[model samples]
Target: MAAEQQAPSILGFPHRPEWGAAAHRRAVAGYLRRCRDHARIGARQAARCIGTSESTLSRLETGLAPLKPVEVERLLDVYGVRDPAERQRITLLVAEATQPESWHPYAHAAPNSLRPLLAMEPAARRIISYEPQLVPGWLQTEEYAQIVIRATHPTLPAKEIDERVRLRRARIDMLRRRVDPPVLLAVMDSEVFRRQVGTPGVMYRQITYLLTLLEDLRYQLRLHIAPLSVGAAGAIGHPIVHLRFFAPEYLPDMVYLEQYEGAVYREKPSESERYLAVLNHLCGVATPADQTASLLRQALDTWR
Candidate 1:
């Protein structure tokens, strides 16, 4: 009897090299990494084939390094990727990655660790983002974000702080485009309102915004507040995000965990399953969607 084929080690995604027109930068970066792993080539070998250093190759695989079209071509050639459709898809990803971000200077303010997530957002079919600390970045208003920026980076220059705030604010629009946007189900800690951020005014406005969004007739957003009763029973202390692609075989779901110095992306099936289970538990314990708006209103009244 033949043994079952083991999943690819890199992205843990099913293989379909002949997929079409994948323009998402994150998807491309992931695809490239998987191809290299599928070919069983070491970083040194890839660097030699692509005329770059091992460190550079590592960064490219992690989506940290800026990728040029020619570089993608070189890497693909060395990885033995001969599929015409896959080549075109990767080439399109190169174009998308090289395009200028419209948010300009603000967009440039975010660190490399975060850039990949933003790139992935456009391509994600569904997103499950959890925050135990405070409001999720995408849902935060400018005033609330300003307070967060100051508190997080107390020593940052005023100009720089403003830039960071604008950058975060820009993230909201990234998900609001009328075109095909990913469905976001943000599960947050119940302490969000109870926890003081900047001032009562800021907290009030932010809560008000949350209330509005929950009531918004037009969004695929599912805002769930995990009640304080659940407490430590929830997932780990840190934040977690799981991103699923439209084409399941094209790129496996990725779990993103952010730390102080950097972030972690888990593509392995086992790791992703654990995170997904935690999120499901949190969702189960969280207030029902119908009651989320009411809870926000109660919190909003306290601010008033």
Candidate 2:
């Protein structure tokens, strides 16, 4: 009897050429290491059960090579893990981790480790971004962005920081130049306008800059303020940049979650849905756009 065909190795996800398989390799290796530790099984013993040499298992665990899905199943079975839910979860994660990150090449300009959720920008239908602390890069004025870059990256030499700010400003041009640009939706917390990163003069200019951007018909700017009554709920956690695309293939909806030190692009259906829910809740709790603008205007008037 013929053996059943094994599932395909995740050669590339989203079918990009410069995909990075290493991230999945590392994640799978980490999982295997943890599993081995939990089961109190030595590499040689586990390797014997999985029909691989001890050194091969060591290499796989250390991410020197990719682990086959069948081998992964074998390891889990030998560990005597009986929980069906956990088994399915492990198998799914193993597949996902192996799926190549198609955005890895673009990550060169940014940090190499950033798991950015970027598809073909030219094909997206709508781009929704929310920032509670700083101006979204897409809407930032040149000077305001410079002040932010300088203040946050004090260690970088002034020239390098200037170049970085310039690159950031250039990215904004896409909103205007793209033939079919995504309808840009920006929702900022009122405190974003109030937070003074530079001189009073610089901040005044920044507020005016945002007011000017609001004049653009294509810019669907919906600024809001989280009230003090909401307490910490109003506080911005990590900035979330969600992108929705109009593709017939796997491309659909994605969320780009950013932290100061790292970022991850979440394409998993459940994760994407959860983020959308969080945004909806936050929007419901936040003050209306007009009120947010009024609060911003008031802050600008009081800034000096």
Candidate 3:
């Protein structure tokens, strides 16, 4: 006979603005602790009821370990938690825990859990990326990469920065893995291409590198330009990306947004729809891919 499953805890809560997954763990731990206290139960007693050791219970209660659904329900039932709202909330949390975490493995023990989502996405069907402040990491040249990495993380040790840069370069290898790689379309501000980021030499080489990639036939890459005029139409934002996953079974699109500390992967239909709208606006206003290629040639000429 198969073993029976425990009831799931309620889960739907707006994630915190910072430390998203970590914050969720802390909140669930706090809720569990309150339940225990209300029951007047000691750690050992709670542990016994949940089929775990006292140390395990203590770690979970202290928010040091991620909460599991079975453990949540077993403990809650033992504590006689009868609040329907709390029960519903715990149930929602359980569901969120089970949702596919695209970036969970790559994330450091710290707060950057968001990085894994994009890295783990089932290869995207199409990718639209725009960056105004810097060269996108996927297209950055090695020397340009070092300068940007060092500038952004002044406090980080030189060795650590080198390791990170190495990893960034390695990630680019993903572009050539498949027979038909994802279609890449990018738009950059005119000034972004003109400004020298690392050194005059690095800047010159990076521009040339971009030109070389434009001619790569194997990777269906397309480049576009969004001039300053388009900026007035609300085309300006942190490097925005719209990736469409080719999941034949699922009708919805997945969208991801990244910030300095973390990112959010939005699978909700509404969120996906909003990004689609933004992408349409940007694509319509930006210069065509062929024209952008000409502009890139012009920029390379100016650099020489």
Candidate 4:
């Protein structure tokens, strides 16, 4: 009888099981780029050493393409990576990068532009969000989400809308249930409360939910209201989500900007830091967290 084939071992190198596939891919790409630079190898030289085109190497380094195990080994060899433990760890990263993300099932309902953000949210250590028009998706109640979805995508069928709502709910539940949930600091313009999404009832329920989350000690959430009273403040005037990961992951901070048709992602430190600055300004100018509940109550009164 033929002997059973065994999978190759990772030599006991630990991989971050909590990170999603997107995070792993970015880490692998960043590590490969750093290794090549550290070895004083140009892109052309590295590509030639690996017997591939520079464009392919560029894609792999940018996280646009996955690196095969053989390719990883060859790159390590070329980069003079002699440390056995480092090799094992990178090999494990490549393996994990190829795995499916939890958001894969919602791919059909989610826009291609938004999938990357979905995959990265779970792996983030801190999420700083700013909303000028409406409540952020992570804090939206079901009724509020449904109304927002329908208004935003009037052409989408009810079934598709329901799927989107479910996706948002899943994200909220994941954060709530996570043992070490990311620290969420959300800043919302007071106009969000005055916008009146669905109905007075919906707005009331949603604000109540926000208050409940703010009061819950178990959640690492901080809410701030950018009061309309703070007129002409230095605000970004659009929605922004800045996600920061732990250092051990080797992942860079990412900024997500949503537009009407598509979204834009800023990964460069300079670009992301600009957005971070705007968010920081908003946070600084906004009502303090302790006073947020009062603003919420004022809105509740207005809705009432």
lDDT per prediction? 0.74, 0.63, 0.65, 0.82
Q: lDDT by residue for model 2 over 134-157, one digit each (tens)? A: 888766777888888777667877
TM-score to native of every candidate shown? 0.78, 0.59, 0.62, 0.89
| Best-first order by lDDT | 4, 1, 3, 2
Q: Please report, as a residue range, the 10-residue window in candidate 1 with the lowest summed lDDT.
A: 14-23
Clashing pairs in 2: 24-97
* Candidate 1 Cα outliers beyond 4 Å, as residue runs: 1-26, 29-47, 53-64, 74-86, 101-104, 260-262
lDDT of 3 at 216: 69
lDDT of candidate 1 at residue 30, scale 0 to 100: 69
* Residue 300 error, candidate 1, Å: 2.0
lDDT by residue for model 4 (165-278), tens:
989878865467456678889999888998988889999999999988888733678898887776776346678999988543477898999998889999889998998888
Instruction: Order the numbered candidates by TM-score, best leading.
Output: 4, 1, 3, 2
The number of the candidate with the highest lDDT is: 4
What's the true lDDT of residue 88 in model 3?
Answer: 72
Flag regions of model 4 displaced more than 4 Å.
Answer: 1-14, 48-51, 217-219
Off by over 4 Å in 3: 1-113, 217-219
lDDT of 3 at 69: 88
lDDT winner between candidates 3 and 4: 4
Better of 2 and 3 by lDDT: 3
